[model samples]
Target chain A: MDFLGDYTLRIVALGAGTLGIVAGALGAFAVLRRQSLLGDAISHAALPGVVLAFVLTGTKAPLGLLLGAAFAGWAATLAVMAIARMSRIKYDAALGIVLSVFFGIGLLLLTDVQKQPDATQAGLDRFLFGQAAGLLRSDVITMMALGLPVLVALALLWKEFKLLAFDPGFGASLGLPMRALDVVLTGLLVVAIVVGLQTVGVVLMSAMVVAPAAAARQWTDRLGTMVVLSAGFGALAGVVGAVISSRVERMPAGPTIVLCVTVLVLVSLFLAPRRGLLWARVRARRARARLRVQAVLEALLDLDARHGDGHAHSEAVLEVAGAGRGGAGRTLAELERRGWAERRGDDAWLLTPAGRAEAEERYGGRR
Target chain B: MTGVQLEIQAIAAVTAAACALPGAFLVLRRLSLLSDAIGHSILLGIVLAFLVVQELTSPFLVVGAALVGLLTVVAVELVRGTGLVREDAAIGLVFPALFSLGVVLVARYTDSVHLDTDAVLLGELAFTPFDRLVAGGWDLGPRALWVMSVILAVNLVALLLFYKELKLTTFDPALALALGLAPGLVHYGLMTLVSVTAVGAFTAVGAILVVALMIVPPATAYLLTDRLGVLLGASVGIGVASAIGGYWLAHALDASIAGSMAATAGALFALAFLFAPGRGLVAAARRRARQRWEFPQTMLAIHLLNHEGLPEAAVENRIDHLDAHLGWEPAFAREVVERAQRRGLVRSDGAALELTDRGRAGARSSLARTA
Candidate 1:
């Protein structure tokens, strides 16, 4: 509570938190639409717009710069679409093209602005990898003002957006103007991305967009729950990132925030129910153990069937039935442990009647 | 351009060509973004190599970058194999993590080291000539020029030697597997070339230009031709053009050389997108327009032919009736008929339109084509 009492800390946390929610909500749509990297592309493309806006208006205001960024983001999306559609270059390549080229232009302009004697181009370079410490009260207010509308739009068009993400063809069939809805959604995504750029930066902003939604996806199946969870996770990462970077010497907040969200995503990937890697691994181990026990039981049943009078089978025979070398010993031991079979000496085993019945049932009584 | 400028341009061209060779295959395989990932992640390798060898000019730099570049691909594939994330997301996840690690390493070691993050992200081709390679106490021209030349040669030789294998694996990996070409090995080979080229180009043009040169040239070439050989040649040509053009542009603007090169490459791509002969935007648009114009004229002739002596022949054969009958605007209908008439496919007989013998023959062929 005392930590939160610091005014500057509170502002940075709020600003980062607001950014995370907006980016994460929009990122869910981007991720679902398989345009996860659109955030990256749009952010990079927004660089030139930011500089251009400053030059044109000569204003250091956040709103004006973000508006310029939105325009550039929209243009980049269009360029990517055009390149993908008009040429053989795929969407990913088109994305790369716009990203590097626009960023290059931005760099060139920044350098030019810096070399000029009269222009005070300080802090413009922060857009590369954002410095959250630079966030002002006005900037935070601007972000909230810009962000709330994007959130409201996303909420208002939740059903339509869901249809667009999950089943655009179905939405179109229902006379929903799916294409126009897509444009609006993309526009909203641009707005969300532009607002986050000053905090997370062009290089790492996409991670903010992708990681929260990705983590949320691990914990939920329903879209509404996922979207809500994603926003929360994103905000958590942002605040945590802001706190950590503030405490640590010489650590930039944007990448720190990105890494925080990435850690969340990795944790979710490993520990979430059903889809988690830990559960999958556990299930696999159980499945293998079950198969081995069944194999040993079947081998015993086969020996009993061949002898017709309850003869003990040697361990070598079990090995020959596909349990190679050491597997035969372990399989037999497991069977004995279950009272499914009994060892003759140390090298042989015979199935109990119960084991025979169970084996027959398992194999559909084929034997 | 001055001598120094010429040398810088030459270095840029060589770097671009080397990158473009592997880039062509990358574009074809739809693994274009993976190149970007590799370019970014190779910084880790360079930093590790520097830490180990304690020298910036060692051959191990290239080796280290190649190893990490390969690791980046392997790591991405491993993540993708888990079935959690798609290929693109996996790439996005892996590279940023490695890049951030590299950035932190550079930051931590900056006091004792000369590693400049700015140069890595944005290169300085303008200063390449000053960093001359001295071998056996003899000046061996710019270090960047020699390194890039060696890499360019290596790339060209590899592409030439494995041309068939590369082509087979890229266009149809399953067939390459059937033929025992070992496409996985070829894929690794191509990746190694990309890594080597990226590292070689790093000192001259930096990561941004490396990504640009690696992708844009081949993408532009894709728009220009369908043949792989022509595609390769066109990409190399475009790469050299962008390199030189970017050099002059940077000189004129007095900006960052690498940024200018990337921007130039982008401009070249834009031009190819609009104006490439077969598959460009302008070409596609023109083809669509021609089709639109010709289709209506053919329909008009066919309509006249269908009503040659029928009851509606009187109405349908009238040129003005075309607007109402076909639901076309009056001006558009008039234009179609005039075009047909100019081509000797139609004749007007005072308020009535009729098809000539040539028009009838044309209509029969159109019907045959449809049938």
Candidate 2:
């Protein structure tokens, strides 16, 4: 409670939560565009930019680092595009190469900085994996200032982004400036990644951008609903991770936030009602049950067709279908409830006209 | 040369050789990013091995990392089967969770362990050579070299033995399955090899550079050629060249050796992207320009012939008419006129144009093909 009462913790938590919301909203498009890995790439590529900015401005100001990171991130995106378009290398391969190379250069620069004997280098190192506990009020304000316009732009261009995502060819035919829209979207993603870097770091920032959106996707297919839900999930994960990190000792808030987002992703993977693994299993079970009932009805119809009076022996029919006696009996009760079958005394059951028609239609009338 | 420098160079050579083999297959399968996932997720294996053996430098690390890498593949496949997420997203989801778990374990057990995150990410290539494989104090700084050599040999043997099978499965899994080949088994086998190669290389080059080595070399090779055999050969060549070139560059610049190596590989990929024949940017532009010029020339010729009365049998003189319609210089007009004459499209004694039997047939066929 005392840790939570600290001003630094409160400020950092608020900033992380707000950044998480923006990241989650922007990440919906990133994931949909299959550019989730771009977040990882761009965040890493920003390292060189940060180092260069430090060298250029002779200060470790957040704004300077942000500009440098944004430039490098966009440069990485351009390199990826060039590799993909001009060469046989696929987008993933291009992304991997660019990310490693840029980050490697950044590391070389960091080592150079380390040799300089300056205490300010400590703050720059914090940007590597982020230290949320060190964030100031001005940082939080800056995050909101940048995040608000991004959210507004996304709102105004929601229809265009949706159309471009669903079908770029159609959008182009409709005179939508798809190229410009793509640039705007990529710019938004780069900004989100750069801002979130203060809280999530370069290595784990991608998880913040991808995990919440991926989790939210499991619960909904609608784009607007997904974006909103993902934003909510991201905010919750951010607040929970911040609180937990504050309560605990020696746990970095960035990885903690990523861990929380990851937990939500796992939960959604297994437990979402509409499209999760558990739901899929339940749906499969229901389908199998329906198939069994249809199979029984089909067997009964087969027996009726073979007999002149349209009647069949129930026990013999059940023996041939290989369903358990209890299952057959349960299915018989269900069919009767649905007005699909009728009891003939205690030894036999017969299909009603509707049952016979449905059975014939389903099984090709052979039975 | 200093002993350390020589040893590091030798290890880099071995690592580059090891990554090149399975990397060729990964690129072909479009699973290049899986190498990145495997590279990151192998930390789990290393941690698990340390937990079991309580030692950082044990053979069990390789086995454990291999197991975890294979597990990453299986988990990704499981997620993909759900149809809820696409293949890329499934991969993006599963590996990060595994990697994050590994990071958390490291952070939680930092005091009890000597594993540094910096070492994990960047690798200690300089120190690898000092950890020698000496039996009875014989001073052998070649354990990594031997390990990589054996792995590379096994990989090559497996690829040679199953070349046809791998090709069939990679190009068309359905046909391979129908022909009674088990694609799943091949997939798992390839993944295991990738894991082994990744682990072997990680010791020498570190995770990030290993990832760069695995993807960039093969991707550059893909740009240069389309044949699988040539692609494999070119990838290995590129890997070796980058390893050597980057080692020297690092020495010259006094930079992080592994970082320089990865940057070199990236530079090679960029070079190939811009300059490789057929698919290169300059070549494509040239082809487009040539096509543009030839298309209009062909259109002008067709229009000239059509203007001479749809020219089934014969055509009248039309030089002045062509010049008026096409707006060509006399030299350009003469070139077109001479080309048509060479093709037997006209018989002009400085006066009239006529269609020969072959020319008439060619004109009709060309028009039909165009239509």
Candidate 3:
């Protein structure tokens, strides 16, 4: 059976895709600003908000819970900023403090709510790890309603937010209210986190904010391109993970989606152009090879100036030309492969006309 | 209290102290989130070890977890060294992927392995007493208590032996490097202790509260003291206190012990953040309040001294026109005038205000400081 043919599968895939796009876009700013961990802190902090909203409102209406999650996450963000700024404690420590304490508070609340005799909170803990199959049509609707405004706001504040991410001090010096803009940007991040909490769950939602942006960063230097690419990667992972998990028996979509996105991050880290690890290794290897070829060519050219063209230089001369560091045989073979140098009588060598020309182009004028 | 209750508290307190010991250094080094990372990544080790050893309580699990914890640090450094990702993002990238893999493994083999999700995330601090360590036929109290005590003792010994080295390296790495002290060696050593401590505390504080215990108490202590010795001692004391307080909080509410403990630690940090002398929120705000008046008075004095004999002196000195001349509000000008008069910095000559000798000296000193 086709996976998208199923109603629940379609709903969850759509919901997760929407969440990915929203988180991926907003998360780019967080990643660029060096606050990738702030997303982690806020996602954990939103747990108590989710539980408290359920306890106080007696309704699991998405809006009320979302508002509660947003408020708590926003407050946690403020607390982390305050602690980092007011005290000697650094930002990581501050994030640690706020995140765990708030998460602890959330856990306590969750346990308390579950113990109630009349409580209908059986599905509440599911928000912790997220069961994407539990995502209803209404939940998908709520995600869209929330994500639309968030992406719109992101588009509207694109320039200011970009400045806030890259050079907030310069913006502040220009009287741009950098602090307020920071609050707004972080607030959007909190919203981004809360919306995804139902789909990805609170625990893994932090990865959603980081993996996409980090992967996208390896591909582009432009902020606009990075943001768009990040969103695209996130959505791709979400839809694919959702669809695949729907087919697999007993495989939870949330972790599966996280696994998918993580694969993307790993792929990007090793394979993306320019900044990719594989590319860096390849470029370094090529550069080293080019240098080796150039050195051997220049040595041949040096010999040409001394002994005239096409002279069969002994392997001993090649060793001297190689200097104390030897690899003359391999260099000669590579030269032969490139038709640049020819071996004479097993050990001696001669530079071809083209090889001499190439060497001259590289070293003759500079030498 | 019953022996069971006492043993549980002992495990909690000892675990807290053990975490706080290396935790203070982590907080000082700005690697507090590494605790969070280490705590989660160690789960992978524990899970893999469990799969092989077929026992969750095996010491091999601790060894495996510690190795994974170290691997996490190595992995983070590798990613960050690439210059493709920032340090925090590197952290954010590495831990969850490890944790997600662990979750996947646990979920995949749930039939054969009873890796309780709640027990993994929240721990079973309350059940620590039930898991008694037995030697030959002798019951030697709770296993967690024994694990934490040995780890705590190891942490204390390590701290005492290397206190100076740790202090110098943490406070001034460049100076330490120039003096031939290997900061990198000290860093890995501290991280090893953190990883081992995290594994020991994993059962009592759970994984997340391991981070809370390691960070909150030390951060709270940092607010109260700048001395390294005092910081270390206070961090331990605060951690133990939070453990006890949190144990009681969970007892009262019948909630998660580790979470309650973390909340208690946070509450203590909150108290210090709001009220710690010289550095608390209240103290800093009060200091700024005083500066508000102090700054304006110095500016007024400077303004008066600059114009005392100039053509504008009469207009600038006139009490009625002071607001217009200085761009101050009329009410504020009057208030400044009254305050200056009361302090004997100025005197009224008809409608014009004159700066006295003390005011002139104050203005001159202010000018000297600025120059």
Compare the candidates by lDDT and give the number of the best one.
3
DockQ score of each predicted structure, in the order shown: 0.60, 0.53, 0.72
Off by over 4 Å in 1: A1-7, A322-326, A364-367, B303-333, B347-357
TM-score of chain B in each prediction: 0.94, 0.86, 0.88
Across B54-150, the per-residue lDDT of candidate 2 in tens digits comes to 7877889899999999999999898788887777777777776777677767777655348766676777677787677888978765687778888
**What are the per-residue Cα lDDT tens digits for candidate 1 across A238-288?**
999999878777677887888788899889889989888999999998988
TM-score of each: 0.93, 0.88, 0.91
Kindly report the docking quality category of candidate 2. Answer: medium
Cα lDDT computed for each candidate against the true fold = 0.85, 0.81, 0.88
Question: Which candidate order results from sorting by lDDT in descending order?
Answer: 3, 1, 2
**Candidate 3 fraction of reference contacts recovered:** 0.76
lDDT of 2 by residue, A134-247 (tens): 887877887787788888999999999998788989999999899999999898888888888877777778887888999999999899999999989888988888988888
| Model 1: per-residue Cα lDDT at residue A47 | 86
Q: Of the true contacts between chains A and B, what fraction does model 2 have?
A: 0.50
Tens digit of lDDT per residue, candidate 3, span A1-367? 5644587788989988998999999889899989999999999999899999999999888888988999999999999988888787789999999999999999889878878888877567767877788888988888888888999999999988888988888888888998899898888899998999998787789999999999999999999999999999889989998988888876778878888999999999999999899999999989877877887777878887887655788667767876214477777789999999998897888889889888888788997
Looking at model 3, give its docking quality level: medium
User: Which tens-of-lDDT digit does each residue in B1-371 have in candidate 3?
Assistant: 88887888889999999999999999999999999999988888888898899887789999999999999999999999989999999999999889888877777765534776557677878888998899999998899888999999999999989888899999999999999889999999999999999999888778888999999999999999989899989999999999999989989999888889999999999999999999998999999987877777777888888889999898877878766767889788877777877887888888887889999999899999999
DockQ of 2: 0.53
Clashing pairs in 1: none
